[model samples]
Target: MSYVLAGDVGGTKTVLCLYQVADDNSVGGSMEEIYKAVYPSAGHERFSDLITAFLAEVTQRPERACFGIAGPIQDQCCTATNLPWVIDARQLAEEFGFADVYLLNDLEATAHGMLHLSADEFVELNPQAMPQAGHAAVIAAGTGLGQAIMAWDGQRHIVMPTEGGHCDFGPNTRQEDALLLFLRERFGGHVSGERILAGDGFGNLYDFLRTSGFAAPNPAIEAEMANEDRNAVISHHGLAGDDPLCTEAMRLFVRIYGSEAGNLALKCLPRGGIYIGGGIGPKIRAALESGVFMQGFLDKGRMARAIEHVPVRLSLNPEAPLLGAAHMALLRSQG
Candidate 1:
């Protein structure tokens, strides 16, 4: 059996997969989930080192490899936005003795993965609209915000990467207007959408609420946060409806998230749909369904109805990037 290696290289974790694509040119056949593993991205100093460890686990060298990385791909190389690693497809191929290697923006990989996913893999957020015929968009908020679009040419999905997450954040309410100023002063210049929509952004919002006197912190939460993951702690308290400050932070976060999601829809006019992927979406699904996200999304005045027709859904498959990378490896192998 010919093996295809795929890697989903993200800010927090890196997942590597080895898939057995049949020699008969069948890619997505059943019983093809070979081996997969996850490693902390930050804990490793070099991506090559991580690959080396993973390669040792395999019985033999893979014929082809592809990596979906969390940054822009240029000249066969990528410097991950949230990590200090620089990945070069050529270097990887040379070092690993592979005939070819491919690199893609993580969201681009996600879009590819979306094509292979079954209907059961997704959780619908807006079931009112049908999956319209046109372009489709994917927006994920994990360590960073990643955006991509898929062109449906009446046949297959052609995925494209974008740096839209770095755009200026437009606030929808007075409290958010104050949030922009607060973030601007601290971030020291422009506050991008990723600044307030990502994992660290949750902590930033919680801190802002505490400092702005809008909500006071609990001693227990402060103590727990001293050791536990701050974002997780805040999200836990917020979603449980226990802490007022935490709930308010979640509200603001949902608001900003929806606004950005809507902005992406407006720009791309993704009539096909909008898929919300990433670590954060599934974690805060309750908060998202609390009407804040859709409210901020539909608050776009005259353009509201158009985006409303854009189906919103969540990608529950965490291995989507890996699956996408494997698909890319299959596609590259065909050529």
Candidate 2:
């Protein structure tokens, strides 16, 4: 039996999985999982090296492979956004001896995976949401922000990857106006939405609050920053309301996140809905559920009503990108 390989490549970590395809092309046949592994992305010098190491561990070589990468894809090649590696689909196929290789933007993969998920896997944030048939949007904030659109024809969804997260940051309030100036100066130029909406945004916001006298810095939390992931620590304390500064940081983070989501909705007018996926969304579920998120979402003047009924869903599954890559591989292998 031939094997199919799938991977979810991210800034922090990479997960690879192998599945054994059914020998017969029968209607009831299915692929079975055979192997899976996770690796720290920073530990490997090149993506090719990581692939070589993974292939060494498995006995069977895959005939086809697909990877969901955190970057823009061009001509089936990608220069990873947060990693220092260049990935080319054709080169990997030749080097790894695979019959075919496929690459997708991380959010595009997540959008494909969303189609396969069950209703229970999603938490609806819009009380008045109306699920309908139309185009849809997907936005994720992890190490970086990602955005995609699922253009639904009468038959199926066509995932369109975009670098919308890099768009200019729009301030909705007086405080956010200050935030724009602060980030602009810190970044030494044009500040993108990701500056205040991504994982590291927690630390940025916390620093702003502390320096702005929003609240006195917590000595204990500050000390932990050096030992742990500073962003994660800030988010943890912020979500738990353990420190005033951290709490405000989370509030501001959630606010900006929702505003950006709204911005995506305006661009695509996704009537099917907007699915929020990423490593950070599930962790801060509580903060997202607070009314602050929705308030920020609807804060748009004159255009708020256009997307009020569009469903805003938070996907709880973190392995969606991996699953999507696997399924895409299986489909391509069959064809």
Candidate 3:
């Protein structure tokens, strides 16, 4: 028997899992999940410390390990985008006494995992979707916005991670033009799409609407924001239509989210598909299905028909990154 360690490391949280594999250790080998846990990313000062704690609770020592991290990976090293830790694959392997270790960008891992998921795990948003063989794009908005491209090489997909989320924000409507100005002033200049599409975007959008006199600020929501997760509160009220300010914010968020997804589709022309993954999408499922998102997506001036039939899917599985890491480790181990 052999063990594999896999992790999905994000800015806000980290999830680690241990999988027991059959003796064969082949790509077709059977595997069973033995343990899994989630931890606050900020609780550990070093990535090594967190791994050490995880290992202490388990009796088996993994032969190989892989991590899907939220940052750019260069030369097997990563400086986590939202966390204070710098992770090196070789260093982790040496310190942990593992035979091998691999690091992949979080979106890359998600893209890889998408191939292994069952059909039911996805919700196809494009009614006119046409599934075919080609490249695909992934866009996820979590603590930050993540983007990746899955290039199909006739046999398999080669996942390419990107920092495209930090690209310049383009406004398509008059309201978005005002939003750009507002975010520019607030961020001191040059606001990225991530500023309006990520988790914190709920609060940013709500504040923008309130200051714009869209509606009177709800004192109850304000009080809740002071104590609880500001974004959560806003999204909750927004989804429920309990407050005009939050509802409008939610609408704006969905619009921008759809627009950005369209932009990604246009850029890559992911004829295979474009997938939506992140913590925020499922929670706001109603808003996403509310036609506003689709309208924004199809708003592409002349190029609308080019990608109109391209499938857009939303991944319901939040553990995709971890699963991808595990499968990737398994494949690498076989080689």
Candidate 4:
């Protein structure tokens, strides 16, 4: 069987997959896979070591490879956004002795894989409408907020990456303004959407709420999160309905997340739809479906009518980026 190696390289962990491409132009199946391998991207300083390890572990040798990198791709090389690792495609090609190699923005890869997702793979937060074939947007909140747009270029979908999450956060109300002030004092200067929307951002927001007197602390959730990482503990407490502070933080998070998504929809004109991807969205499925997200999304003043028609879906598949990398490798091979 013909196999292609695909990887989703993240800040904390890397996922690698060996996939078979089918005749119908879809990834047939994954023969081998690795999930959540801990690699110290700093100090180690090379993607080659990780690649070598993956190659040694897999049973089959792939003919081609594609990677979804966590940072900008310029001239076939990249420096990871949060890590100190530098990835050189030419060096990787030399090391792996592969004829084909492709690098893409991580969010772009996720957008490409969205084309193949079935209804069962996603939880529809807003069932009020469905997607049309036109423009679409994918926004993810993980270690960082990643954003991308997909437009139908007459025949097929073309994914475009954006640094939009880095754009300045616009306050919607007095409460948000106060939150911004609190964050500015802590972080200094401008605050981006990523500052309040990602994994670390959850804690930041929670801290802001606590310090700003927006919510009172619930000792149980606070203690659990204080011992562990804040996001997971906060989410657990919020979902369990055990803590009022956790609940409020979650509500605010969903609102901000939805507002940003709506802003993205407006900018991209995603008639095809808006897809919510990344680690956070999937875990808070219940909160997103509880009208908080949709309310924020449709709360736009005059343009609300336009956004109301757009369908929104939460990507349930965690392997989307890997699958997309394989799909890109297949496309490149065919060309």
The numbered model that scores best in TM-score is 3
- Total clashing residue pairs per candidate? 0, 0, 0, 0
Candidates in order, TM-scores: namely 0.94, 0.93, 0.95, 0.92
TM-score, prediction 4: 0.92
Q: After superposition, how far is residue 220 of candidate 3 from its true place, in Å?
A: 2.3
- Which candidate should be chosen as best, given lDDT against the real structure? 3
Q: Ten-residue segment with the worst summed lDDT in candidate 3?
A: 23-32
Clash pairs, candidate 1, are: none
lDDT of each: 0.86, 0.89, 0.90, 0.82
Instruction: Give the better candidate number (2 or 4) by TM-score.
Output: 2
TM-score of 3: 0.95
lDDT per residue as tens, model 2, 1-335: 87889899988889998988788875323668799999999967889888888899999989999999988899999999778999999999999889999999899889887876779999999887999999998999988888999998987788898989999999999998988888888999999988988888988898888777887887888899989999999998888888998899999999899999999999989999999998899999999999788888888899999999999999999988987787788777667
Candidate 3 residues lying further than 4 Å off, grouped into runs, are 23-29
Off by over 4 Å in 1: 24-31, 42-45, 82-84
- For candidate 1, give the lDDT: 0.86
Candidate 3 has an lDDT of: 0.90
Q: Name the lDDT of candidate 4.
A: 0.82
